[model samples]
Target: MHGPPDARSLNRRAAIKVGVALAGGIPRLGALSTDAPLQEPARLKARPGDPTLKAFAGRQQINTDGAQALAWVPESVKRDVASPLVLFLHGALRRPEIYLEQHISMADETGTIVLAPFSTIGTWDAIRGAFGRDIGVIDASLRWVFERWRIDPRRIVISGFSDGGSYGLSVGVANGDFFTRIVAWSPGFMIPVKTIGKPPVLISHGTEDQILPIDRTSRQIVPALRAAGYTVDYREFKGPHAIQKPILEEMIRELAGRR
Candidate 1:
């Protein structure tokens, strides 16, 4: 809520107000006050639960749409090393907090900033998908994070499992300028939307997935993406509809630029 660590109190309040307004769906900056410069939140290196990611620790920040998120910031960044940002979306009926906890160490291990946003509803737009309000809250939250963190824009990633995975493909492709990579685990389908810069994509689906047949899912989607000239890495695992820990670890390492 507070402006960047050194900003004045007035700036902090003004920034919070501005953020609230933007989160409320006013996409136009002119609507808030074209003349005012919204100060960013101060860099809080660590919070209560995490001695690593201060304000970005375990707490949930609710957006105007009532959507919420949990984030993790790496403990340190090597000299000349630009930290990456990873936003992981959970499957349907899943909590972002769980994803945060599950991947907390991934941040330190990779010197990455991790964010997991929860859908305000039972699931992201239920059956009515296509990067709706959930995407808005995500974009706003990411903007807020950007104000405080010096994340590498070229390494920004949008990844998820199941339905979240499907949405990641749709949104990441649409917002290629912001997200350089998309990792979809057990994705169902992609919402054929206008795509931008050919961001690299990683699609992993279980061969035994009964919920969504692989032949009709990643098998087809990966080829289509490649046909569209997008770099793709497709992996087929023998299992049911689920994300394997080993695959998760591999993906994180890949994103971190580690072999």
Candidate 2:
């Protein structure tokens, strides 16, 4: 049900087509409009009778009012402690559960909470163009998480892979003050509506990324990010267009310590 090679998949072929189409040029962004109201983020509450607080980690389909999201929360820390939260956006056609499992170690190793939400469609809304419903879902999810956990607002990070990576770059940069850090893996591009405070960014790409070739992605993204004056930490791997184990480990390591 996650990502394999479906017809609706945004595979390497899809990446190529999209990248080429966007080659024309990206539009400049200003601040987001104040209209188009979105449903307020839902709050999570623990039942008074509960002996232990809910410590759950799985696929949680949330119907926050009319909004829908797939979030994966790490098991609650013992003694009712707080943990850092990472909002991970999955690559095109990928599922949130798989992304959580891939980085499951963060739960115990760093006492970090992970939340991954699905896009309205197969790929993120910004991938095809500008921001859309997905952004609303993201906002709602963060509000939901904040209601339950004692998250350090200063340590929240927006990160993702591929298409999700690109969207993360766009949104994270636009709302830099909101997200202290932005981690992007093999991102295609960074297009934001408006600029915000400078948030340090971490990026990694494989040398042999045939899909969104390195030259066309991180190579461009890193410098542009730097040109924009963002503190950037970039890494080049000897793998493909995927987030290898070591890359994931490093991401978690830095995130866990960012707070």
Candidate 3:
């Protein structure tokens, strides 16, 4: 589990701040060059396979080529029945095991299957530079789950926290044709490599977040997305760089069309 903000994690956050500073207060979005692997054609090929059998119940490990990944299938989801899928990305210096159960619990309540995949390194590949190795890992995990369960193409979601959240906003938008919705918790900045579709976004940030200040982060991001013609639901709460469970629960329900 994520014990506390360690020195390495803090340094990573500091480096993120430096990057934002270097980019004139707002980190640049989209690919830096055409040659960059921002448009990974192969990684986008995974789609839900025909389910002959039901998905495995409860939490289980998924083979993502040595990269740790996990999936949670609720009992409410059955074979051949279209189920919602969430591809959850983790924060810096963290693993999927730390927060997979949280998503699992939520999945149980929402009847959604959650797939949490750890980055190839400390954080997402796009956060360090451009979308690279991690996209393959994610694609492999998605394929593993998709081959077992019939997923509803309309409810596919990409979500994350901190660095993961930032990457989610970027990648989710870039691959919007695949993901219908995006949930970002305390995201710092986005670096989208061209948006494919206009997927609705749900973003929540803590007012007192020191790691990624709400002022320069979500406050700015929400409007930018809105101005860009993407539907955005932004929520700001009184707290730190942490999630408020009730808000997430409500938003997830809304995303599921439960509310």
lDDT of each: 0.62, 0.67, 0.75
Model 1 lDDT per residue over 1-259, tens place: 1111111222345434423432423222112121223231111121111122223433345453354677777657532345677888776665667666666676778777788887767556622433456766676567555555566656778898776787677767766656778899877666545555677888988887655567666776777678667899888888766777777777777778832
Residue ranges of candidate 2 with Cα displaced over 4 Å: 1-13, 22-59, 76-80
- By TM-score, is 2 or 3 better? 3
Best model per lDDT: 3
Candidate no. 1 TM-score: 0.71
lDDT tens readout by residue for model 3, 1-259: 2223521256665756645653544546433223446555323668876865345788878775665688888989888678888888888886677667666667788888888987888788877777787888888788888878888888888889888888888888778789888899888888846667788899988898777778888887887788777899888888887766886677557656632
TM-score of 3: 0.87
Please give, for residues 1-259, the per-residue lDDT of candidate 2 as tens digits.
1122322355667866967844634322222222323331111121112123243554566666445666655555432555666788888775666677777765557767777877888888767766667777777666656555566666678888878788888788667657778899777776544666788998988888766778766887787678767899999988776776676777777777875
What TM-score would you give candidate 2 relative to the actual structure?
A: 0.80
TM-score of each: 0.71, 0.80, 0.87
Which pairs clash inside model 1?
3-42, 4-40, 4-41, 4-42, 5-42, 45-54, 46-54, 47-54
Score candidate 3 by lDDT.
0.75
